[model samples]
Target: MKTITKTSLVAAAGMAAALVAGGAVAQTAGIATVQPDAAILSAKAFDAANQQIATTYKTQLDQAASQQTALNTQLRTLLDTNKDGQVSQAELQAAQAPNSAIGNQIRAAQQKAEPQIESLQRPATLAQAYAIEQISQKYDAALRAVVNAKKISIVLTPNAIQYAPPATDVTRDVIAEIDRSTPTVTITPPANWQPQQDTVQLLQQYRQIVAANAQRQAQAAPGAGAAAAPATTGKAPQGR
Candidate 1:
């Protein structure tokens, strides 16, 4: 069977989290600093925006999975002539011969479906990155106001600081300002939009590395029935 695993797609999605968070951190000189996570979590509109993105992509993933499952079933049915419940290496080799009718059909189906399956990975990552950028840009004014009110000269993300008193944290104040000004954000993005070029390139590299590793592991796995030698007869059979 020709298997197109989605390990790379999942790796790309995991990289998106870093990209989103990277945009939220900004360096400034200040007596007080606020954690972006605390502020973002507290904002109801930000939460809603994330939920909307997740729902949309989850539906897309479900549809893609269903389509791929149907295609795999068709390919298996054509190749498993003996109906032994497993497609052995020998059986697969026979089906893939140049003149094999079933083999040609399987190859054709895979050619049509592979691109459709691979296309889902990038957009899924882009949607979340776009949503994060939009929310951060829309709330910048609120965040600035909190900084100014506290007479803070610098604003740093939580990770940048080694230790600080609770009194120096302005996360709650920023959240309150965001809630007051923008109660809810729009979920839909403009047409034909894409994420920043740098982020896209980084994600692509990460996917490639993960995919290479998965391929190596698959190649090293033992073939079916390699674990035990054929049972030996007690003695050679008598001549007929």
Candidate 2:
């Protein structure tokens, strides 16, 4: 995905909405920007798979969440020597001295929990990868069709530019094309099927976007612990 960073840009509509909001740029010649990953995320097939996976893997998902919380707590207790609520990489490194007892305990705990976490997450992970792969198979053709139809001579990612007019962004157009081409994707992967390495990375970015959206929604909900501020600090994970 990174290899296509400039040539093949990506963004979901939710995130792209913010990026595409700026002064209008009037161009006589064809020029545009598209977010490929976001287009895929916004695809109908991807949304359906997300919902299906959440329901089908409810047990594993719940268990994984609980396990992650416990692991974070353990890591904090072991490495947060200064008693900060958060643990830092420097603290972790310092705790893992050549003959440190804390290092041995941390290593042992992580080793034991690592496989358990992986096992619990495997189903949903593979399911997501499969869905992404199914949709992404049509990306090239969809992009090409959009470029030809829109007469876009030069395309760039929103990330590559400081600002651009909303009209200059063809992300939504591309997403529509993707949805039309691959309306629905499957969560069920074939037996012994393995995801391509790129799919796995894309899956991770997808999860990050989902998590960020969830957090944003939670903060915006009434009676929440804290008021949700505008999300300007965190940028969506770039395609890898």
Candidate 3:
């Protein structure tokens, strides 16, 4: 029951290989900079969670990597076959047969490993999900406790508010709480514990802002209209 499904094994291995092969980094203006990613990834809780996952899941991961490596070796051998001090046309043609053969080996390996890895990885991913949820919940609880204990009217995640007094950020306590309640042995996110806010509030806010802007624009229209007429002196306003 705990075996890695072949799909999981192959996918996990492929992703790891891709990462190791000089992975492409997306170019986002500020986000691509080393400092932001380093700061986020270096956080103790994040490192702890990922390391814990790796520790619990490393066996299958290693096996997957090993399988992938073997496939790569097989492929390379096929491509480089008959390469003995001279590159010949016959040798080149002969290599195609081996290429086909190597492809078969890799495919077979993927088929076998995919099921095993998936079965194994499902449990780990479930654990990850649970842990993230627990951490977030604990963080919320701690924020509430701190807010109530300190008699503060509000406390928020740092980026949530456009501007708050320095005291409003309860990040330290949140992190402490999150770390303390880290999921012991799970990777799956809780089905009910969605961390992202829903669309209702966002839509409501957008509508309110739009209405206010429309009102302001309407109020200014009379003044603007009286002064500008789109250079009508040259062409009688094109449609009038």
Candidate 4:
């Protein structure tokens, strides 16, 4: 039997084709994104923007730390939680009620502050966002560019390939396209979309409590530190 070849096509004004060169049991077609991980674009710019956001909310974060201490202290006072060194479920519920209220307040505050932070960080964020959008668009363009330039019908990720005639992967061409477009492009989260200072403050406070507990635990049980590694993770844990 003759092996049939296939091709890949992207909708972003690009075209490509695949050539078959080996005998095979079957052929398959599927769709996959040939794009850079959004999380990897212009790391320095994104990191800077993230650091600024933290700096902007530093004061609030400190306030949150204080409040968390007071709340947990309040919990300690209640039921000793029976002095067992852990709050009773009932006592825990009681203890958390006020914290929950505080959380609501913090959320409200964050809602208030998000806009301001958004304003201050707009230029940097826009630059990053634009860069990513370009990545998505250009990766496809590059694929098409290479395919059209080479006159192939399709291209695939290196992994998708099996035994076949060697052809230019075109991934390099696609990457170049992404670099050209993504770096120059820009995106802004919204001039009005600031994260709330109040919420940030609350988050900071909660974080402080968390840190204090972590430190205490580290002191109490040093081994836990290796596994419970806590970091202010995620300037873009959600995405790049």
Computed on alpha carbons, the lDDT of every model, listed in order, comes to 0.54, 0.64, 0.38, 0.36
Error of 4 at 161 (Å): 10
Lowest summed-lDDT stretch of 10 residues in model 2?
A: 1-10
* Candidate 3 segments whose C-alpha is farther than 4 A from its true place: 1-52, 68-120, 157-159, 163-167, 180-240
lDDT by residue (16-114, candidate 3, tens digit) is: 111111223322221111121112222245444555666777775566446544543444444444534333445444543565664455456546655
Worst 10 residues of 1 by lDDT: 228-237
**What TM-score does candidate 4 reach?**
0.34
Highest TM-score against the true fold, candidate: 2
**Candidate 4 lDDT:** 0.36
Q: Which candidate has the top score in lDDT?
A: 2
Model 2: lDDT to the true structure: 0.64
The true-versus-predicted C-alpha distance at residue 28 of model 4, in Å, is 13
Q: What local lDDT score does residue 93 receive in model 4, on the 0 to 100 scale?
A: 51
Candidate numbers sorted by TM-score from highest down: 2, 1, 3, 4
**How well is each residue in 54-139 modelled by candidate 2, as lDDT tens digits?**
77887776776677557656856877667655556676667666987877777777677756766776777677688888888888
**Candidate 1 segments whose C-alpha is farther than 4 A from its true place:** 1-30, 37-42, 54-58, 65-115, 121-124, 197-240
